[model samples]
Target: MREFDYQRLVIGYHGCDASVRDKVIQKGDQLQASPKRYDWLGHGIYFWEHGPARALEWAKEQKKRGKLKTPAVLGAVLHLGSCFDLLDAEYTDMLAQAYPLFVDSTKAAKKTLPNNRPLDASDKDQLLRDLDCAVVNWTIEEFEKDGTAHFHSVRGVFQEGLKVFPKSGIHRRSHIQIAVRDPACILGYFQPPSKR
Candidate 1:
């Protein structure tokens, strides 16, 4: 991979319950990391890059579903140390190499490889992506075993839905996502300025 200046900081936004936002502000620390097996970008604290509106939308949706009492957006400044950036061909090539090993391991364990299923039969807006998540996490684990590389975070751009215009691969829901594997990378957090 090309040399990346890990000292540079980037802005990210996260959606959550208002109460959760308040706790982070009061504690002066990042929210707890998520280590779910099916985490899309592997186990980490996820954030939408420069996507405060998107974060708010997600929070509002959660509130509508009764999962959250109040919607809010938290902005963060991240120091991406040794980031595994999928946008770069070098990292992607590395991941490609790791896939075969993952497949072999799963086969040896007599387990079916997870598949990316639609969130709902009628909703194409989202995909489950369990397999993708598994492979990525597995790749990281394998790399760590080698003791040659350690990634503090993973960053990728996802394109969802059809293009807004003809012939354009860009999708309506295209957005950048960052999964911070190391909590120390998050320098600080703040509530975003209210759109209202």
Candidate 2:
């Protein structure tokens, strides 16, 4: 994991209803969205919107103007509510509070895997193990022409044992593939001063 510098973030949640949209719009800096999933009859997804570069610049500016409480980077906003239903977990508070920032950036993140399968007891163990070795830091890379940010990190763990369990009764321990991305990269669309 790597350290990033960003400023001025927009964090929000997008669900199936107007209420979800309203809450995100009210708390976030900007509201960009799309349609909900068919299953989202009354709920929405979420995402955090921000640029790492501009945010850092803003922090510097504030520091110059003596507005900062300390010469430290401002934290990110993560939406726990958005991931709750998506992850099918009743409690993500532990993960959220443990991490400095946890946000639901968009409904796009809620999409289930194409080959969805129910997790059995062995799969559950693998998931817990992978989570324990989760990535903690990230970096943001941007494409100048497209303004698209590519997030990359070196912290994710990939387990490598695909077959061993019984097909019908026992579950196979498929390796976990943790995807890493930089929260800072999301800022490219907004144009942060550091990059501009």
- Name the top TM-score candidate: 1
lDDT per residue as tens, model 2, 69-129: 3322222243221111213232234334533321222124673222212235554333222
Give the TM-score of each candidate. Answer: 0.91, 0.19
Q: Which portions of model 1 show Cα errors greater than 4 Å?
A: 1-5
lDDT string, candidate 1, 40-79, tens digits: 7888899999999888887897898798999999999988
Question: What are the Cα lDDT values of the candidates?
Answer: 0.85, 0.28
User: Worst lDDT window (10 residues) for model 2?
Assistant: 135-144
After superposing candidate 2 on the true structure, give the runs of residues whose Cα lies further than 4 Å from its correct spot: 1-120, 130-154, 164-182, 187-196
